[model samples]
Target: MKCIIVNDDSEMRKTIGKLIGHSRGMKLLSVFNSTSEAALFLRDNCVDLVFFDIQMYDVKNLEFIQNISERTFVIYIPEFSPFVNTTKKPQLEQLSESTIAKRFKKGVDEARIFLKLIKKEKPDILDDYFVI
Candidate 1:
């Protein structure tokens, strides 16, 4: 799967980027330290997966995520577990908050598993991660 990393922390970006690179059947297309740069890149390019932080400068990450094609899956690396109120966001309403919590709590293991499940296209395993 083609992917990108968008995080303000350089270490976080590198860690996630390396995880993607080390994973089988995944490609790290690019990495951006800011959401604005990422948004510019996303406007012209199509990617299979995006791993990004929920808190970004100026832009509301949910709005940016909503603007992207539904075909692309998003895995949010939120600052903390249970931070986002899913009900407030229309795009995230269908997904389970518990699942998102588990993801945020598990770190790299969850990310690796998410990508693997996505690659296999198994909705059952994927149901634990995201809905769309």
Candidate 2:
């Protein structure tokens, strides 16, 4: 699956990018230091997944995720407990900050399952089905 990482911390970005590089069937398309940069990329590219930080300085996490294409899955890396509420959205998944390497593969597997289920249930669903 094609993917991107969005995080303000350079170290976190490197960590996640490396994890993606090592994962089977996963491709690291790009890494951005902020949500706005990722958003701009999304406008022209069609990636299958995004690893996004839930708290960023440039954009509101909820709004950014809500606006992205539904076909593009999001795995959130939340920085605070309060931001965990964003996972209430059915299509959104959260990766535990404590065990990123352990959880990354699980999150990707879950996303694949979710896309299959959604396609089975509504074959004609638009890519914009993801909304707040």
Candidate 3:
């Protein structure tokens, strides 16, 4: 999957970029410090996944998130992000600190797990995947 990292912290961006680079079945497309910049890139291109940071230094991500295509999947990077993981969307998931350092070392296991869920559930943005 083609992906990008958008984080206010350059260090974090670098870290995630390196992780993505080492990830299996994943490619690092680009990295951005601002949500708007990432949003602009998302407009003309197609990416299978996005690694986004909820806490940004310049612009808020709410509008940016709204601007992206529904087909794209979002993997939130911040542990303190505002989103509550109540949805049954297979494309959405949060990163935990315990697994951050070992994420890529484990061959992008988290992303692999999420992608497996996506394949099994096929959750779309417009509709709920689970009805029960």
**Mind giving the per-residue lDDT tens digits that candidate 1 earns over 51-125?**
878776645676777776555677776543354555453334344655644553355455566666666878676
Q: Ten residues in a row with the worst lDDT in model 1?
A: 86-95
Candidates 1 and 2: which is better by lDDT? 2
Report how far residue 66 has shifted in candidate 3, in Å: 1.0
Stretches of candidate 1 off by over 4 Å are: 80-132
Ranking by TM-score: 2, 3, 1
C-alpha RMSD of each candidate structure in angstroms:
9.0, 7.1, 8.5
TM-score of each: 0.61, 0.72, 0.65
Q: lDDT by residue for model 3 over 1-132, one digit each (tens)?
A: 888888876667776786677656778888888887887898888886777776565556789888766555666666343334554422223545445655434434544555566667666623642110
Task: Tell me the tens digit of each residue's lDDT in model 2 across 33-130.
Answer: 87777788999998888888777776466677877986777888755434355545322236355556667777888777657766687656554343
Question: Looking at model 2, which ten-residue stretch has the lowest summed lDDT?
Answer: 86-95
Error of 1 at 7 (Å): 0.6
